[model samples]
Target chain A: MPSNDKLFAYNLGEIVPLSEARLHISDLSVQRGYGVFDFVKVQQGIPLFLDDYLDRFYQSAQLMHLEVPLSREELKQVIADLTERNQLPEAGMKIILTGGYSEDGFTPMNPNLLISQLPLTLPSDEKVAKGIPIMTHDYVREVPEVKTINYSMGIRLLQEQKAVGAEEVLYAKNGIVSEFPRCNFFLVTHDNTVVTPAKNILKGITRKNVLLLAGRRYKTEVRDIRLEEVLQAKECFLTSTTKRVLPIVRVDDVLISDGLPGEVSLQLLQDLKDLEEAQMTSPKV
Target chain B: MPSNDKLFAYNLGEIVPLSEARLHISDLSVQRGYGVFDFVKVQQGIPLFLDDYLDRFYQSAQLMHLEVPLSREELKQVIADLTERNQLPEAGMKIILTGGYSEDGFTPMNPNLLISQLPLTLPSDEKVAKGIPIMTHDYVREVPEVKTINYSMGIRLLQEQKAVGAEEVLYAKNGIVSEFPRCNFFLVTHDNTVVTPAKNILKGITRKNVLLLAGRRYKTEVRDIRLEEVLQAKECFLTSTTKRVLPIVRVDDVLISDGLPGEVSLQLLQDLKDLEEAQMTSPKV
Candidate 1:
């Protein structure tokens, strides 16, 4: 028998079941793909780093010229209420802000917020331990920083990435590998310095946290990262909401160093976990 | 009393009501805006230039690496059936090919094709006589030729365009005004040479017909079109499926010569309408 766990969807101002949550076909979100979204992880019934997620979400909305229908505090309350209703100690919440339904398309009108929760799908321990291979694709996102619903270039090469036995696709512009489709990447120099591209990439929350934590003890530098430096580096890793400090063993179909998970990546992964655990154990927000 | 009229939505292989067509929230088309679409103008219950529309639609899908689930003949048959079922003497049909829903959102799967018909909204003679004003935005579409669901850049400037009292947004790369967001732009030189940007613009079916008709009577050149040339040209116009030929009287807060519709634009509009009338009178394809 299947479990009777009901998933909740916060559509506009109403909380409905996931199946009942639907936007009209005339909505700009569906018609012209005008929308912005952000994902936040929940732990032990507490929404984690929701403020940061909302910050990015609102930032994306501003960049896309979409107005958030609800106030920031109201949105926060909605997420908290949804988390309480769902009662999932460990899950992920995705908040979407879309351009509202309109007969005259391409004009900004009222905005609709659709919030949904899903079971977290983090990178497995084994996958993280052995590290994964990534292929390089020469393409740049239209708006590198704003997390819009435009991913045509990134996802169009999915089959090719799978064909190469690659777990992710890394994007490069003019021989500079900046970021993957959904994550931020970093490098560990031969001399033990940690480096990541400072621009032309979305500033991932996990990446920001890792940088803050690592700056306390390690030589951390956020600057321009060329493809040559990535290939010549001792080790490299990637960071995102679901996948934290995922070591990259190979890039561009070539093994990095000895084709093993780097020491810095392992240490940073543990560091991030400890930080997350502390945040989870702290008083509920 | 309300008249009973049922609007049909072709969702993949199923023909359902327009309201009944719903793609999953996790579908790549919704999540990542991975899709391509084309619009066809129907006249007197006949689907006009559907072959040309489908060719461009397929070309866009191919450019985006999206595979249409149905073959050309099958899709054509479905379109014909849908048109016949609707029985609208004059209408506009929009066909959308989306990246299917998946457990993993990025990869392209079995495509979902959606076809919807809407009452035609064409350019009026009075409005054409007092030609439209357009504003130039300094941005280029990521894929200028492909009709992908990436209109964020175009739509984000909606407010700015409205502030300037502009009807549409024309995109420019550097100083070359390539095309409008939804139409192909053209200019007629002082020497009566009709010129349009050969590349970096969607090859609209109407544009092709206009070019063919004009090339026979006038010296027509399809080449690079600069903003300076557009401002200096004797006449300016744009073409699309719904709007056959629209004369552009003003651009970038500057009034064109005499601030009125040009002779070439008027002639081309009539010529294009004659061609359409011939096509309509010809045997149904």
Candidate 2:
């Protein structure tokens, strides 16, 4: 699908064309792959869980030593203005913080921030219902706790995942499943416990919300979920801003829950949607 | 000081302006930090050790699964064309290979290759005479063998290094000195043995030449050199395409041999200069 032609996007405090929102070639984001970013879902022109996202965004920036060019209130105001100017009821707001260009190519001088909103491409009902298949690979991310723009291993494994008829690849190191390429991996144990890796993975906002929802309804264990447990899991799912509690029906051609989406995964997804619905019905921020 | 104004740079097989050399936002190099690059020094319009640099560039590309869009011969011709067009007698050539933009913004589709030539800024005489001071940081890059663009940790420590009046940071993990942020580090032991890390480095082209020079004249050991050994070494230095064999008279607060450039490191620098002189005086490619 083609991207929506927006009249303006938040580019270094000024609204510019989405097509023309470009950074210098010397920025660390382009030169050294040093950057941090966060995504939030905007519904009915209201950004859902803005505080959670901005908090995590700040954490990510601090981890990478990228100073956000704007203060918290200023950043929020920029996002609100972008949401208003774009006039999109539903979209994905991506906030990127990069170490700005330096005189010497390798040094960090200043920080640059850019905000862009992309029209949401809702997942197809058929694919959502059938769930997505993912392949597993033995890999792990550096500084796995931060939402940095270093996805080299994940992108390299794209072809191998496609060849296996999978949509994503789950990363496992030493038989311990850590994360999916770009999302948080969760598994429902045979005893009806929700387990996800607590280390060497990004603490995704969606994963946090799902954990909160799961805690009230079922037993939740946040620890290292090994590949062996994943293989024997009654159900599997991934969580991200774009994919909230997406079901995983198969792994490495092994049918998960008889190749069906489990009830718990669907229920948690409904929980997130309910939260989003409440925010959408409320007044805009 | 400033980049040379080249009429065209090789951009995905098409020649484009140096200022217009831009990649799509969805390219993995920008979005995912999945890319590899190598730099070759050109003096007097001569590309020094072009073959060795390209071989390492291809190795780095293969390690990251980034396919170069052009063959070695084609790439050489493009670099030659870029050099001639730029008309820079002394410069640096940066070859970049990236997984191209994806339709879904998460997978590799096509590959993009670009060659850029930048005007060389000669280092100050004071910096050369006094040598450079560096601080040791306990961090290691992912896939340290490949020259990928993931320098998140190094960039994060730029401020600390600057605060200490250091030119760079030497990466050490568990007291084992592996490499500098962008160069291979070497130390001259008390017994006059040349030592460098055998693993977790890019195997610099300059390092290769210096190693050859040291092997013929001194006792050389290509193995893990600890930080303690570095503090106690008679002298220390770094090797890279741009910096060549630069002496390190001080690391953090500890001064090497009373903060004087040792004879071994100076000799190695002279050896690299001699090799470059030979290359430049030879027939231009």
User: Which candidate should be chosen as best, given TM-score against the real structure?
Assistant: 1
Model 2 over residues A3-85: C-alpha lDDT tens digits?
55654677766888777766655566667887888888887788888899999999999877778989999999998888888
Interface RMSD of each: 5.0, 2.9
For model 2, the interface Cα RMSD in angstroms equals 2.9
DockQ score, prediction 1: 0.45
lDDT of 1: 0.83
Give a tens-digit lDDT track for model 1, residues A1-285: 002239877986899887677665666766787888898989877777777888999999998888898889999899889898898767888888878766665565788788888777788899988999999887777788999888887777777887888988888889887899899999999988989898889889999999987787689999988888888889999999989899999997688999999898899999999888888887343
- Candidate 2 residues B135-174, lDDT tens each? 9988777688888888887887888787888888999988
Q: What is the lDDT of residue A210 in candidate 2?
A: 94
RMSD of each: 2.8, 3.1
State the displacement of the C-alpha of residue B102, model 2, in Å, after optimal TM-score superposition: 3.5
Off by over 4 Å in 1: A1-5, A283-285, B1-6, B283-285
